[model samples]
Target: MIKSRAVIARGKGEPVEVVRIDLPEPGPGEVLVRVQACGVCHTDLHYREGGINDEFPFLLGHEAAGVVEAVGPGVPDVSENDFVVLNWRAVCGQCRACSRGKPWYCFDTNNADQPMRLEDGTELSPALGIGAFSERTLVHAGQCTRVDPAARPVVVSLLGCGVMAGIGAAINTGGVTRGDSVAVIGCGGVGNGSIAGAALAGAEKVIAVDRDPKKLAWAEEFGATHTVNAAETDAVAAIRSLTGGNGADVVIDAVGRPETFEQAFYARDLAGTAVLVGVPTPEMEIKLPLLDVFGRGGAVKSSWYGDCLPSRDFPMLTNLHQQGRLPLDKFVTEEITLDEVEDAFAKMQRGEVLRSVVVF
Candidate 1:
């Protein structure tokens, strides 16, 4: 057993505590990782709010970059000392989705299958099955994707979740390409990533819509060609105006609110793609006019983990980061020790930072 300091979330709507936890040696096909850095995400906050599930005592923080410390039997692709990014979807190759060659949609992705517990032996449920808000974590071997060792862990770690989701929503899910005009609503990390992805894909124009001035300024750094303060104007109208009155070729709703969804619905050109990368609560229901749905001949899709295949994306994006193509370092607003996670949550709640990462 290994005793490691970790952030422990007791139950719904409770603050996390810094405490020592016990992690067992990896079982077969599992690898233990010494986390270098982990990002604080809204999903982690959601887990704390009981919005995810009933599982309590959640070990939050999933988006992380780490080094493999130990390997269990039968793990072939990785070894000790490998620098890797942890992914939640450890795709099971024989699943129906994988059988059809779409490994991204694998239905039976697995975790370590062994429980991490507190010092006294109470089980700790990992957030998104990774739980890297600690000195060490054990995960399925498939969850660890090796990347270039020279890259900074803080920058590359963002690709483990939010940044990847945002960028992939435009490139992978929405299929943004050269000359396409894209409009992104809600300029958070995901939204900005979408804008940058659109730019990287050679989009002719990328419009960022958000209520926060600071976020709008940050959007420009992420390759947004134009900005709209949604609070001061009609977001849909602004997008249409920026797109020469025809509307953008793709409209993305990254806020996940009903109002933002409605704005996305009308902000796209005819037959343009509408991608929803933001998560919403079950209590939120969107009402769209049936006529508009029929009139809009485009696809409205939702991105799960950016419809990503981590093995395919992690390496490529890391290479992009190394090549000075994707500005990953900008996403990290600040870094704090694991014990400061609670305060970081408060800053996130106040919209003061893009990402407050925990560096172990």
Candidate 2:
């Protein structure tokens, strides 16, 4: 067993703390990763607030990049000292989704068979099956996607979660292409990622919608061609007006709320796609006109991790970042130590930072 210091949320509505835990050696099909950097994501906050489940004493943090310290038997894809970005969707090749050639939606994703435990032998439910907010962690071998060693861990780590989701929502889910006009609601990390992805996909116009003026400016930096302050303007109307009164070709709801989704539903052209990348609470529900739904004549899709295949997307994105085409580093709002995770959460709630990464 290896003794590692990690961040844990003891119970619902409790503040997270750094605690020592016992991490067992990797078993077959598993690997031990020495986490170099982990991003403090909103999912971690959801875990703490019991929004995801009643799994208390949860191990938080998943967006991470690290180096493989050891690999268990039967692991041939990676070796010791390999730089990697950790992903939650470790696709199981035999699942029905994988059999259909849609491995990104694999029903049976892989995780470590053994558990990390507190000193008293309490098992931890790792957030998103990763729990990478530690000095080191144990994960399925497939969770580690090898990336270029030349890229900085702090920069590339964001690709493990929000950034990848945003980009994928535009390219994969929204099918954004040249001459398409895209509008993304919410200008957080994921929303900005959609903006960047839309630009990368050759969209003619990228409109950013957010109540915060600061985030709107940040969206522009990520390639948003227009800004819609939802606080001062009707998002759907602004989007339609910006698209020459026809609405956008693709509209994305990164906020994941009933109101925002309604805006996205109405803010698209007759045949435009609408994507929901943000996570919504279970109790949250929306009522829409049945006629409107039928008349819209477009698809309504939900993006799970941007429907990305880590093995295919990670290395390609890392290469893009290395070539100076993608500004992955711009997502890092600050670099903090493990102890500051609680404070970082507060800042995140206030929308003060895009990402406060824990650098080990």
Candidate 3:
């Protein structure tokens, strides 16, 4: 066992506390990772607010990149000192989703069998099965996707969750292609990532929509060709105007609110796809016109983790970052220490930064 400083949310609506915890040795099929950088994501805040579940004394933070410290029994293709990005989707090949060859939708994901506990011996619930807001964390070996060691940990760590979801939402889920006009609603981290992904996919026009001017500017930095202040104008109409009054070929709703969802639904051309990568609260509901849904004649889908296959996408993205094809570095607005996670969460709530990374 080893002692590590970690951020923990003791209960719903409580502030996150940085406390020392005990990490156990990795068991079979597990690997112990010394977290080098972990992104303070909105999901961690959600966990704190009881938006995800009632699980508490929850160890927050998931978006992370780290170095393998040790590999447990039967783990293959990974070793100590390997730089890796942690993923929540560790496919169980025997599951129905994987058995059918769609590992991205793996119903049974793998996680560490052993638990990291609090000093008082309470087993902490790791956020998104990761809980990377620590000096070290134990995870299923498969969760650790090896990437180029040269990749900046602060930048690449965002790919572990939000950035990957945005990219995958465009390329994998929305099927964006060259010459396609894409509009992404909500120019936060995920939305900007979608913008970047659309650019990477060779979209002819990438429109960004958001209430915040700062976020829209950041969106531009991530390759947005146009910006719409949703608070100032009708986003759907603006998107249509930008796309010759026919709307975009693809519209991504990165803000999972009902109003933004409606905007995304209407901001696509007749045959264009609308991808919902935003996570909606359980009680929030969408009421769409049934006739419109039928008449729109396009796909309406939700993207889970951008429908990504981590092992395949992570390395590819890392390579793209290395080759300068993908500008992943622009996502990290700030780098902070683990103890500053609570402050980072405040910054996130205030929309002060795209991503505040906890760097070890």
Off by over 4 Å in 3: none
What TM-score should be assigned to candidate 1? 0.99
Which 10-residue window of candidate 2 scores lowest in summed lDDT?
321-330
1-360 per-residue lDDT for model 1 (tens digits): 988999989988988999999999998999999999999998999998999998899998899999999999999999999999999889999989999998888899989989999988999999999999999998999999999999999889999999999998999999999999999998888888898889889999999999999999999999999999988999898899888898899998989999998898899999988999999998999999899999989989998888899999999999988999999999999999998999998998888999988887
lDDT of 2 by residue, 1-360 (tens): 899999999988988989999999999999999999999999999999999999788989999999999999999998999999999999999989999999999999999999998988999999999999999999999999999999999999999999999999999999999999999999999999999999989999999999999999999999999999999999999999999999999999999999999999999999789999988899889999999999989899999999999999999999988998888888899999999999999999999999999999
Candidate 3 lDDT tens digits, 141-195: 9899999999889989999999999999999999999999999999888998899
Using lDDT, rank the candidates from best to worst.
2, 3, 1
Residue 119's lDDT in candidate 1: 88
C-alpha lDDT of residue 291 in model 1? 95
